[model samples]
Target: MPSESFVASRLTSGNRLFPTVVEVTDSAVIRRRRTLFSRSEESIHLQRIASVRIETGLIWSDLIIESTGGSDPITSHGHHKADAVRIRDLVTAAQTAHLPAATEAGPSRACPFCAETIKLTARVCRFCNREV
Candidate 1:
């Protein structure tokens, strides 16, 4: 079985279509070239498929194909999708955490000239103080 991450990477890395020479069986070899076309006009060549196999199982049959192309594109897409999901979850969790509650428990500081709240470590009021 192909790795999900590897397959996902290959599927989305801007190379939607892959082309290659395929050896379907021990004696039959065919060159398969797949191109992903945007608007059916602009086409981007993906990879050169070199081989294909039909594996029969107890329930169903599966087609296993292979290509002799660089793994960069596939790996890139997989990494990108995975990274995006991770980042999104991290942001959501951080937002839901007790941010204000933690800050409220610390010492309170205020600007002498204005009623604006400030940080204790601040040398001067960020909103109004001109000199330290």
Candidate 2:
């Protein structure tokens, strides 16, 4: 997937001088904040992301991206509501794209009735179409 960048509105507080920019890519979500002297960046891998929260006000929205590792979340304010939602959607899509591989890593066992290998979580035997 192509990387997308969303910049917070300049009119909002703390963004009048330098707005925050968030970039969403296939693998990660990155937030970049710039000041006069120093620039700061934070990122969370798509697979590690636990949640994406959006607080929408009348004009702008605040976005929070949390990870499963219990670290500080990446937050960006002054974004348009639509932009915030798009960010969340992109993250969800990226995470779900990797879900099947993650799920397929679980253990498998032989189906007693059919003597065929099947996922441990499966209740039916694939080879004989019988309840395992």
Best by lDDT: 2
Q: After superposition, how far is residue 109 of candidate 1 from its true place, in Å?
A: 2.0
- What is the Cα-based lDDT of residue 68 in candidate 1? 53
**In candidate 1, which residue ranges exceed 4 Å CA deviation?**
1-6, 9-75, 78-105
- Model 1 residue 20 distance off true place after TM-score fit, in angstroms: 17
For 1-132, candidate 1 gives per-residue lDDT tens digits of 111111222343343545222222222222233455422211112223333334443432233434456322111122233333432233334334423555454665777777577776777788888443
Candidate 2 clash pair list:
none
Q: Lowest-scoring 10 consecutive residues by lDDT in candidate 2? A: 97-106
How much RMSD separates candidate 1 from the native structure?
17.4
Q: Candidates' TM-scores?
A: 0.28, 0.76
